[model samples]
Target: MLTLRDYDNSDIEALLALANNKLVSRFLVYTFPYPYTRADAEWWISAGVKAEGDVTKVIEYNGQFAGSVGIARKTGWRDHLAEIGYWLGEPYWGNGIATQAVQQMTDYAFSDLKLQKLYALILAPNTVSMRVVEKCEYELEGVLKREVFKDGQYYDVHRFAKVLKI
Candidate 1:
């Protein structure tokens, strides 16, 4: 079974081990450090996990740390919206873990958090993620050309969003 829960110190080792991979970090934002060191994991557990206006959680699969999922609520005029992001350990990729985690987060955002909309900004090259969001019923809002510069190159960004019906 897969679950989303609070981050704890026990996740440090597994987080570092699963996160320290180029393939996993390739499509992620630049802030998600490639090396993913012990200090990074410590900081994440100590500080990053508790960011204000953000709901971050550890993805647990059968009692093991599988990955992470989170949503950052927009401030001020866009307070009803939040940006959702998630990533699964490379070993757990093809098992539909990400899709399930995202679905859970989306439900949490709309029901628990009272969010009106949730969106994901996926790099254009990440077709897998696009498919994931598509499966979750997120509509393609638009595309921003060359909006992201990562790994010393530029890439387009695909914007996908799902809005609450009520």
Candidate 2:
């Protein structure tokens, strides 16, 4: 079973253990940092975890901190839209954990957050993540050409979205 919970001090060790991997960091935005450290987890638990509005949850499987999933609401003209993101520990990959987490989070965002739509920006090389969102019913909105530069190279970003039924 999988669950999403608010981050707490107890999660620090497992958070660092999973996030420090280069393979996991490579697909994430630069904000996630390459060599995730205790300082980063501390800051995240201290400040990054949203106390209100949208939602950011630590992904847990069988009572263990496994990864993170969150929805970030847009401001200004796009207030009804939210950007969702997630990552699972490398060992947990290929087990459909991300897909389940995304589905559960999407339902929460629509029902509780009152979001009208949810979207994700996936790097071109991250076909795995793309498939995950697709499996959760997100449709491709479009592709941004060479939208990001990471690890000394540029990559296109694929945009995927799902509109809330309400």
Candidate 3:
């Protein structure tokens, strides 16, 4: 079963290992330096445990530290909306982990938090992550052409969202 809990300091090693992998970093906004270090995990875990209520955690499969799924509430004009972001360990890909995790997270976002909209800006070539969003019932809003510059080149994003009527 998938569980969304707060980050525990003990998970530092596993979290860093997952976050710094080449395959995992490919779709993320920032790429971590090679040779994922223990200190990296320590810093991440320390902050994650204290991230207030805006961020959330998920343990994949059986203790794989699977990945994190977060909702950053937009301020100002987009205050009613939240931006969703998530990633999984490379070795844990091909499973329905991400789909299940995001679905569970969004359900709470809509009902518990009373959020109007939740969105994801998927990297252009990340088909697997896109498919996960699709399976979870998030519709493709549009393509944000040249929206992000990552790994030295600009990439287009297929914006996806699931809106909950208030």
Candidate 4:
């Protein structure tokens, strides 16, 4: 079973194990360092501790840290929109775990936070991640050209969003 919860200090080690993989990091927008360290994990938890509102969350599978997911709200006309980002451990990939975690988080963002919409930007060539977003019911809004730079190259991203009916 999959669950979404607040991040805790003890999760650092396991979280680092899941996040440090180069294969996992490649699909994500953010670039994790080559050797992800405990200190890196500690620094992340420190920031998570300060995160409030639509900010941070951890994915738990059977009481252990499985991965992480969070949202950041946009400004100006994008105020009501919050962009979500997530990644799972390489060992836990291909299961419905991410789908369940994202579904629960999106529900909370809609019903609890009163967010108008939740969205994600998936890099082109990451077919697996694109499928994950589709399974979550996040429709592809459009393709963003040269929107993000990763691995010293600019990649086009597919924009996806789901407006809440609630």
Candidate 2: segments with Cα more than 4 A from true spot: 51-54
| Candidate ordering by TM-score (highest first) | 1, 2, 4, 3
User: Model 3: what TM-score?
Assistant: 0.90
Q: Give the per-residue lDDT of model 4 (tens digit) for 64-166.
A: 7888888877778778889888889889888888888888888888888788999998889888877877898999999999888888899999998999874
Residue 31's lDDT within candidate 3 is 35
Model 1 earns a TM-score of 0.98
Error of 2 at 96 (Å): 0.6
TM-score of each: 0.98, 0.96, 0.90, 0.92
Give the per-residue lDDT digits (tens) of candidate 2, residues 70-161.
Answer: 99888888998899999999989999999999999999988887889999999999999999999999999999999999999999999999
Worst 10 residues of 1 by lDDT: 28-37
Candidate 3 local lDDT, 58-118, one digit each (tens): 5556755788887878777787789888888887788898899999889989988888999
Q: In TM-score terms, which candidate is top?
A: 1
Candidate 3 runs further than 4 Å off: 31-35, 48-53
Q: Residue 65 lDDT in model 2?
A: 87
The root-mean-square deviation over C-alpha atoms between each candidate and the true structure, in angstroms, is 0.6, 1.2, 2.0, 1.7
| Residue 13 CA displacement from its true place in model 3, Å | 1.3
Ranking by lDDT: 1, 2, 4, 3
Where model 1 places Cα greater than 4 Å from the true spot, the runs are none
- Which one wins by TM-score: 1 or 2? 1
Candidate 4 residues lying further than 4 Å off, grouped into runs, are: none
